[model samples]
Every structure is written in structure tokens, then in C-alpha cells.
Target: MDTVMQPDVLVIDDLQKHFGGLEIMRGVDLTIKQGERHALVGPNGAGKSTLFNLISGEHRPSGGRIYLRGQRISGLKPEQISRRGLTRSFQITNVFSRMSAFENIRIGVMARHGIRFNLYRRIKPMRAINDEAHALLQQVRLDHRADNLASDLTYSEQRALEIGMTLATGAEVILLDEPTAGMSRDETAYMVELIRQVTEGKTLMMVEHDMSVVFGLCDRISVLVYGRILATGTPEEIRSNQEVQSAYLGEEEEH
Candidate 1:
């Protein structure tokens, strides 16, 4: 028998949301391919975050559906979605401020291994978790800060630590919200490389405002405006889309 493959890792169809009488997401639709880096960009309050919240199961949608590998996920919990190989990073730093970098990552590693409060099962497995935590810290270039408190590191280092936790989940489909939202040009460049390295061979969907990051890192771009996708294409195509340029990109440059 021949094997069939799932070409799309994520699918959003007619996704809508309502807060009282106000409509937030107006039947938005998007598709992300397996092992592809996709970007979602628009102005500041164009429902990007709302869409992410709906997909990540932070908020339930009023209508429509989301699918991961053809199975519906719109109504699933965040943990349930994560268990299905999808995970999300927040816009704000979400590390445990008082914990050491090593300890924070070890918690995530434990989550990945489904290690709950079972003391009898914890002894021998802890060494392996520690090793994995160190490896993840190295990948994010924060190994030197392993013993430091999360609150003690620079802003950039803290963001890198968050990425390490995301990796520790062992999620194959990752959703990142503004990974480089607040960074100097140099810091942005370093994060660009870290994101590229850590998310390699995994499906990634990022909502970002930085055009340079979008154009530089994403395989395809989806422009969301007024709670709907205006266009989806390669970098060059989106750049030249007169509709896209006039509706969003051109306006973004003026600021």
C-alpha cells in the first residue's frame, strides 16, 4: 500500500470571534505547510493576537474551525494542543523570574516527559533531564548563564531562555508571537539566527511587526487586516503586491 502524507501542518477556516457585540476575527483563513516558516503581519491591532489566542486555545472561537494534520483543534485546551505537537510563545517574557535558567528549562523538560509528582520515578530520570536542559541552553546561547537567575539576565537573554523552554516541550509545530518585538538591531540579528537554528525542520508560524524579520526569515507571508487575511505569498510577491503595499506595508514604512 502507498502512504499518504499530510501536506499542511495547520489549517484555519472561516475563523470568527465575538466579544459581546464586537466582532474581532472576521472569518479569517490560513494554511501553514509542514516544516515551513510562515509569518502573519499587519498593523498593531489587526486581530493577530486574537487569532493566535483562538488557535492556541487561550480563547474559544465563536465560529469556524482549526485543524492540525486534518484533526480539528479549535476547541482544544492549550495543553491539549501542545500535546498534539503545537506550542506557542507569548509576546511578553514568561520565564519564572526567580528561578535559575537551568531550573526553568528543567521544568519544561519534565513537562515534556510527563513527569508529575512521583518521587519514586524521579531519581534516575533527573540526570537525563538535566543533560537535556543544558543542551537546550547551549542551543539558545545561554549556557554561560545557566546558574544565573532569570531576572538577572539582560532582556535579550531572557527571551532566549523562553525559547529554550518552548524547545523543551518537544513541539513540532511552534507558534511565536513577536519573537523580536523589543530588541536593538544587533540583538534582533542574534535572535534571528537563534530562531532559525532552534526551529529548524519544524513548522513555525510567527506574528511579528518587524518587516526586516518577516522578509528575512519567513518562507511565506500572510498579511492580516481587519480580522482577515489580505494576501499570502512568497516574500517577493508580497512585497510587490500593490494591494498589500498600499493597504499595509507602505503605511508601515511611514511610521
Candidate 2:
């Protein structure tokens, strides 16, 4: 596919973030095309996580602008950004511990379908929403654990549910923060395949520490260093880039 032909769903123009007197993001520019799987990779404290937070409305930029499909969205609140088709999953799994797996996903579908605050109404009676939630669970291969509480699920299963919840939002642009963090080898492989399947035909921006996963899943890769983008290219190009090699992969090679 001619990935560049796709429209830019997210555009960052000279983006900068400052906390107190320290500049966290030093004039970064990025463009994320539609249906592209773009991986943002960097070392610890390189501001990969901070960039995701900034995009998802968790933090306001100190300078520069963020655009979603040509519309400015840098100043919008988190909920407003979500409503505008941007959703994010954190590095840590965030699920309703007390609710059943099915119920948790159902709640997400409800919110996406604009029924979240249906007070005095029984969620069980919402057949449409319930069915959608079940389908999402099945998509994530968690249908068998539908009745189990979120807290009862294994760590990997919980992470799957978290992705499902993010998908339930009907987001056009999904930001996944370390989706395979803390996973075993098998679990990581499974999660990678699951994410690939689920994100087909959607724009995905991910922050991943695993070089293998980044190379395997990303159409393009961006390297961040001390809150700035040092380079962006295809997997092979990034792998061969001297700057990337010296800054990040050199450390990997030493370990």
C-alpha cells in the first residue's frame, strides 16, 4: 500500500513541552498517516511516554500545535479528544477490578454508544450494547472469561481487555503505550498478533521498548532522545542509522 497517500490523522508541528524551566520536548515534528502502524522508540526518560500523554490530552503543550485530521486539538480536554476519535491505552492495564470482564467491556461499548450515563436503567436490558461487548470480547479471545471479574484474570488477559476497552471507544487514532510490557515471551507474541489483527485499517501510534516488536509491527519508526525526535524511517533504515545505533541500540548491544 502507498502509506503516504493516506491522510494525516495526526500532525505535530514543532511541538514543545516544558515543565517549570526544563524543556521536556524540544521542538519535535511528526506526522502520522491514516491506517499506519508507527512505533515511537526511545531509551528510558527519552519522553516516549510523555509524548503519548501529550497527544492524549493528559498534558498541554507549552508551545506548538497538534492537529487531528486538519483540526486543531492541542488544547482540548481528554474527554473531548476521546470524543474526537483519539483514544489511548496506558503502559499499565486500567480495568474495572470489581466488574466482570464482560461488564467492563460492556461499559466501554455503552460509553462509545453514548449511553454511559443512563441512570436508573439496567445495563442488562441493553441488548445491542451487550451483544457488541460480547463480540469485542470474542475478538480479543476473552469470551470464555466473560463472567470472570477483571481482578481474576491473568495479567495478559487483563491487558487484552484493556485493548478491547480502548477499541470500544470507536477511535480512529489509537495510542498504545507499551502494550506488551511485563509479558512473557509467549504472551508477548500472542499480544503482538492480537494487536496486529485488531488494528488493521486504523492509525496506531505505539511506544514500545522491545526492539523486536517495534521492528515487526511498525511501518515506520521514530527515535526519541531526551524529548526530541532524532530520526524517523522504515525499520531497516532505522536499524542501520548510525545515530540510532549509537544512541539506543548501542546500549542494547552492550547488555
TM-score of each: 0.95, 0.97
Q: After superposition, how far is residue 51 of candidate 1 from its true place, in Å?
A: 0.9
lDDT of 1 by residue, 7-99 (tens): 888999999999999998999989888888899999877999999999999999999999999999999999899888888888999999999
**Which lDDT tens digits does candidate 2 get at residues 1-255?**
478798889999988999999889998999999999999999999899889888999999999999999999897899999989999998988999999999888877877888756789877777899999999999999999999999999999999999999998889899999999999999999999999999998999999999899999999999999988999988999999999999998988899
lDDT over C-alpha atoms for residue 49 of model 1:
93
Q: Model 1: which residue pairs collide?
A: none
Off by over 4 Å in 2: none
Q: Clash totals for all models, in order?
A: 0, 0
Regions of candidate 1 where Cα sits further than 4 Å from its true position: 1-6, 121-125
In candidate 2, residue 186 scores what lDDT?
96
